[model samples]
Target: MSYTPLVDAEGFAAFPAPAKLNLFLHIVGRRADGYHLLESIFQLVDAHDTVWLRVRDDGQIVHHNPMPNVPAETDLTVRAAKLLQTATGVSYGVDIRVDKRLPMGGGMGGGSSDAATVLLALNRLWHVNWQRQALMDLGLQLGADVPFFIFGRNALVEGIGEIMTPIETEATDFVVLHPPVHVPTPAIFGDPELTRNTPSLKVSLLEGTADWRVLRNDLESVAVRKYPQIAQHIQWLSQYAPARMTGSGSCVFAAFVAKDVEKNTSQNQANAVIFGLPKEMSGFVTSSLQEHQLLGFASD
Candidate 1:
């Protein structure tokens, strides 16, 4: 499935908002303002949510289908469009509709990615023509993870996700399991047991290293204690490969590397894992994305 924008008969452009897997998340330090500094490798994946947008000359931004319990005004997608309108003073508004496939609070960056897609899509729909960095700057105000999605590639993310450095990652297949629980990020961060002192890895060191398998999410332990379902999911998936929780919690994934000359082997392995999942468990197989679908929408 291509991430390119597709226009339907009614003139709504459907944009893909791909999800991200934190290959590993580390809480490096905390700021005076209570924001936790982080270091992580953010890997884009094919698993995504789609946002349908249509330019409105009337200057009224509206979400056609807002998530239940989340007001349209407070929704990130709407907020992103409004922010772009306010920033560039673009007279055009947007009618937004999100087809959400990624799980909420699953640490898959669903909402943040949705917001980034909105920013990128509206930049073109409204003729703002802002550079990618400018959009990223605007995205940071929405959420820390938003900028990385706008960055549009596998990245070494640091400093509360405001800093990103594009990194090379192998095209690998993964089986992602989503435990049926919403792990509140604030609760995880506020927990006294959360590790906030992991020694930061220099970007140079990361670039020099050939193997990233040793790195782990420092928040996993804290999350597992708070949400036992996450631990259960991780334990079950680990049987196939060394599985770890992505980002804060709920979704755990295990990479399946292709062996020999067979490229489909990894994907087949991932599918097999998903096929064997227990009755109550749910998951899907997805491959890493080289870059975001909307990467070229914004200028350099």
Candidate 2:
């Protein structure tokens, strides 16, 4: 299919690749392939990385600012663009630039979101016009989290991150902290004690009256145990509200409802802890997104 690239006055376009929170993540089972079956509520947030794209007619994927030590071929954004080019045989290339905001290894789905953004943006920029399902199928080969970003909603995600049921969640304010550490996802999942048998949540229970706190990240125990700083940070945030680790670890978050996310300081109880965060720690407040910025780019 031929497509006219959505070039602007400058001949380029930019898109947002937002971060996500596993509002609650659980491991319900394991597959024989060594992939853990999961049940989680994935919430999109305003925290995002900006991806800049300029279409190239010659079909060469180039990263204007490739990550340090990571080849353009190795980066997810470039990989996504190349994957689309390969799959569709589109005689188009792209120049990719990223204004990265989310931290690496923070379990925030930053890379996956960036990749999804590339696919969605390039689909328009290159005019491939492939269906959303096709793009998501391609994204899965990149990472488990990539599909959720493409799925484009707060979702009830399961089955090793493949199955998804869209769910409505109240937009919430969250204070997210970056623990001065990195948590390896494989190590957390590989721990013998990691809970792989947590009971599944029925849609009725999840959509009904079940509190979010009822479900917790099964990987939390493994993460906090390996890095006491994770637990310590969670404990500190717990002083204001129930705090939980998002994804595997290294970043923890607490919800805040009673105060302004931007204006609140340590003077008020709701934000006291957020603004009074330890000097050794750094974090920012963000509100949950009801839907992904790319939701309409793909048809469900």
Judge candidate 1 at residue 1 and give its lDDT. Answer: 23
Best by TM-score: 1
- Candidate 2 stretches greater than 4 Å from native: 1-10, 258-272
Looking at model 2, which ten-residue stretch has the lowest summed lDDT? 1-10
Work out the TM-score per prediction.
0.95, 0.92
Weakest ten-residue segment in model 1 by summed lDDT: 203-212
**Candidate 2 lDDT for residue 260:** 55
Which segments of candidate 1 are over 4 A away from where they belong? 1-4, 203-205, 259-263
Q: Each candidate: RMSD to true structure?
A: 1.8, 3.7
Residues 1-300, candidate 1: write the lDDT tens digits. 244668999889999999999888889999999999998889999999999999988999989999999989999999999899899987888899999999898999999999999999888778889999999999999998899999998988888778888888888898999999988888999999888998878555467663556789999998899889999999999898999999887899999865632658889888989889999999999889989989989978
